[model samples]
Target: MPTPVILEDLQAAFPGWCIWRSSAGRLWATRNGRHLSQHEVDHGLCRTIDADDVAQLAEQLKEQETAEQAL
Candidate 1:
């Protein structure tokens, strides 16, 4: 299957803690896609990222559109 989100991306999505691949091989995020792993957060393995982080990521992605437009 195609990998939608990876470990490093998850960490960036939820900064301030470490994030690694779970044996389950699925995204550590929620069904609603709000936060990362809950259990891990409690254990200090990771933390839930704020919505602002996602917005910044979206802005960064605009670079791709700009580049495509130039091309």
Candidate 2:
């Protein structure tokens, strides 16, 4: 499972997505109001990543959110 800090950061960054870990220790995500699976995100969106990459994504998302809010 991801640490609390990483989990909180991701949740805040991706408010419209569901991010979680599976029992097998794999990360998964699904957009809110969508029936997409982790596999779909990986193959279709080409967003397969590890924990470190997730942190980077969180930072990017945070910046985008901030910019959107400022506009």
Each candidate: what lDDT?
A: 0.37, 0.54
**What TM-score, over all chains together, does every model reach?**
0.26, 0.44
1-71: candidate 2 lDDT, tens digit per residue: 23236666777657776677667766555556745456554443423233345655565445444544554
Worst 10 residues of 1 by lDDT: 45-54
Best by TM-score: 2
What is the C-alpha local distance difference test score of candidate 1? 0.37
Please write out the lDDT profile of model 1 over residues 1-71, one tens digit for every residue. Answer: 12224446544543434433346543233223336455544444223222224334333333323433444
Candidate 1, TM-score vs. the true structure?
0.26
The candidate that wins on lDDT is 2
Q: Model 1 Cα RMSD, Å?
A: 14.1
